[model samples]
Target: MDFIDEHLNHIKDKGLYRDFKFFTSSQSKYTSIDNRRVLLMASNNYLDLCADDRLKEAAEKAIYTYGVGSGGSRLITGSCKLHDQLEKKIADFKGAEAAIIFNTGYMANIGTITAISDQEWIIFSDELNHASIIDGCRLSGAKVVIYKHCNLDHLQEKIKIHQGKKRLIVTDGVFSMDGDIAPLDKIVELAKENKILTMVDDAHGTGVLGDNGAGSVEHFNLKGDIDIQVGTFSKALASEGGFVVGSKSLIEYLRHKARSFIYSTALSPVTIAVSLRSLDIVKNEREPRVKLLENSKWFQAKLRKLGFNVLESKTAIIALIIGNAAKARKLSEKLFEEGIFITAIRPPTVPDNTSRLRITLMSTHNRKDLKFALERLKKAGMELDVI
Candidate 1:
């Protein structure tokens, strides 16, 4: 009669149990997966900066200087010299008047949205916004209206309908599931006419979009117009932690009023150092983004040529849509056996009948590796009767 056991039983029946894969080596183009050397296409190490020597050295130097771990919460004792320096550098990189760091991208979204808005604010969110944004809306107790994903017409209609209320418009800079981008330029114009505050969670967009990976805000040239820009260091940055970039007043308000930032232990000195180095690496080495785009375009075009249902992607995320969850899982397993690695995304992560084999590319993968993956994909598609 317990609800927990009932859900567990249902999950077991559906073959939907989830667990982590313990990697015995650093993340890279290839990994020691399930006792076999497999080509890794599932990682978020987009620009292949995770294994870069600069970041490694930065962390090592910090550990030598500041020791391991921040011992207390930021407000009481954990804000180290490195954390302050990192924040300043991030602000400069993001073109924000100021920036504040947080423990994770999830907490940054959760804490900031909750801190800045309240029940009286009407939060208009994209239908496909990430879970963190959804949870943030709930925590804020805001009257949330969901607009169809990336449909500016629907968004505009909702804006006009809800004209009298204090409004906040939020969206994912790059929607994680489908690999498509938000119409930020039009969204900003709509926000301006309606007098709304705008926030974008650029977790996957930071090191993938714009002329040189400056993110969605920069891609749309809305640097100062965006009320908040939340980003993660875990993806293209190849590090950990999150930051909110905005005006000095907003940054200061979150620094003091955001409970998650106030109560949580600060990012360790080594993490701060690694992220700082990543910022340098991402900006100074522009070749990775170029190579990344080439790799993604190659795979996407080939997948379509082979008749697989590859979703449209402008960034590093690519998805092969397979309608049935069981079939999607089978496709992933078959691909793994063929020495390719990918993740199978299913319901709740996406809607029903929209299961997909999510493939992410890195700049480290070469042309031969690219051709090898395409061959394996063709074989897998043929075996699954998908082609």
Candidate 2:
């Protein structure tokens, strides 16, 4: 207990401690936090479907039909008709032979990685991959080789150096922190050349990229090329649960070997229903996706014009870098005071001296909302001397 307090104090002193801001209202472009309405710029609800009437109706209908709670794990009574339906729908949506659902994206990554690889295997991972992927690599007991962020040449060199019969190359399709898209096309070329298995966790890309919003694979026109594809419904889909789509044999293998899937209770039927409805809506509603990307581009340009160090991104995420952690926190607090809600990402989440504001956009946010945000940001930047 003393050690825990010491650790907490140390983090607080360094401005690395975190706490939650409870939201009373539904997740939307604008929501209530601490009973105060603010423009939300930190959520992953890219399609703004979290508060959609259609999704709410779907949840209600599912509740009436199936009741709440999954009752047990998937291999037991928890495997309902909705679960089966959603899995099939996800497989079709991602253009895979089959799919298996997990409790979370974290569980999916860990289970998939640990189940497939062992001490004998070798894994090539990106330096900026999500924490779950990093945990999975560590848990797998495989020889993990980290390549420089989005550096194909580094990945090629690492691939050449790490010789193994069972080799895997895994990366995040859209990096959650940096707001950069992985060069999956070039990575695939490297993998094929080296005969290594490839995996992509498209948690941030699903329902936000590609012609049909299938994700990064579709965005890059390499649908059937990647060996393993992992994604989540909680982000752009505005639902719950994670899923991995691959070959039928791979799905079967995960069913038997993935401990997270085997041990955890399945997602409720209501969640599955919402995910199903959201998928249908996302596939058909291209206007929102287009509008969202357009908004991201416009907002990034505006931030840059205001002299913020904004990262280049093709997706709906914007990373505004503020090198000092305490200063970044202060900037975020100032923005919140001005009725803008943007979380300040800090150390451990990002490398030291790279604290940033991870601004995500929703399609429902029009130019007016963006302009309001930009105005607040400009004022805060001036006050904090961030510009």
Candidate 3:
């Protein structure tokens, strides 16, 4: 208790202590949190499918039919019909031979990386990859070679240095913090040259990238080329599970070998049903994706024009680098006071001296909402001298 208190106090002093905001209403453009209705710009619900009426009805139907919980581990009795259907739907959407599901995106990364790699193989990962990927590499029993974020030349150099060894290159399709995309075309080409496998954790890309929301591989037209493509339903798909799409054999291998998938109880029936409905919405309605991207481009351009250091982000996620943790926290608090909710991302989620405000756009956000947020943001930035 003393150690916990000491560390917590230290974190608080550093302005890195995190506290959750309780939502008193559904996930929408304006959610009631802390008894105030604030415009939500910190959510990952890029397509705004979380509170869709069809999805809610589907969830209700599923709950009425299947109950709340899966009784045991998936390998025991937890596997349900809805789970299989959702996997097939996701596989088909991703244009893969098959797909396998996990309890969450973190579990998906950990399970897949550890299940596929051993001590003999090396993993070349990007320095800015998600924490899940970092932890997965640690647990994989493989030598991990980290290259500079999105620096293909450094990756090539590392690959040359580790010649003649079985290797895997893992990266995020859309970096969660930075929101910049990976160059999958060049990565695939490099992997082919070295005969190494490539894996992409497309957690932030699923249901948001590509023509029909097939994610980064599809966005890059490299479908069936990347060895493994991982995504999560909790993001754009608006559900509570993760999936990996690849060859049928790969899917089978994960089903048998991935401890996270094998040991964890399957996702609830309502979640599976809601995910299925969300997939249908993502596939059938192209307007949401179009609107979301347009809104992102407009918002990013507006932020940049206002002199905020928005990094090279072309996706729904955007970051305004504020450098100091305390300042970033202050900016976030100011935005909250202005009835906007954007989070301050500080170390160790990001490197030291790179703390920033991470904002995300949703298709459901209107022009008025964007205008209000922009006005509030400019005011806050002026108050803090960030602009």
After TM-score superposition, the amount by which residue 363's alpha carbon in candidate 1 deviates from its true location, in angstroms, is 0.9
Q: Write the per-residue lDDT of candidate 2 for residues 1-387, one digit (tens) a residue.
A: 799999999999988889999999998999999999999999999999999999999999999999999999999989889889999999999999999999899999999999999999999999999999999999999999999999999999998888989999999999999888999999999999999999999999999999999999999999999999999999999998999999999999999999999998889999999999999999998999999999999999989999999999999899999988988999999999999999999989999999999999999999999999999999999999998
Cα-based TM-score, every candidate: 0.97, 0.99, 0.99
lDDT of each: 0.89, 0.95, 0.92
- lDDT (10s digit) by residue, model 1, range 27-136: 88988775788999999899877878888999999999999889999887898998898899888888999999999999999999999889888999999999999999
Best by TM-score: 2
* Candidate 2 regions with alpha-carbon error over 4 angstroms: none
Q: Looking at model 1, report the run of 10 residues with the lowest lDDT sum.
A: 12-21
Off by over 4 Å in 3: none
Look at candidate 2 and give me any clashing residue pairs.
none
* All candidates: CA RMSD (Å): 1.2, 0.6, 0.9
Instruction: Supply the TM-score for candidate 2.
Output: 0.99
TM-score of candidate 1 to 2 decimals: 0.97
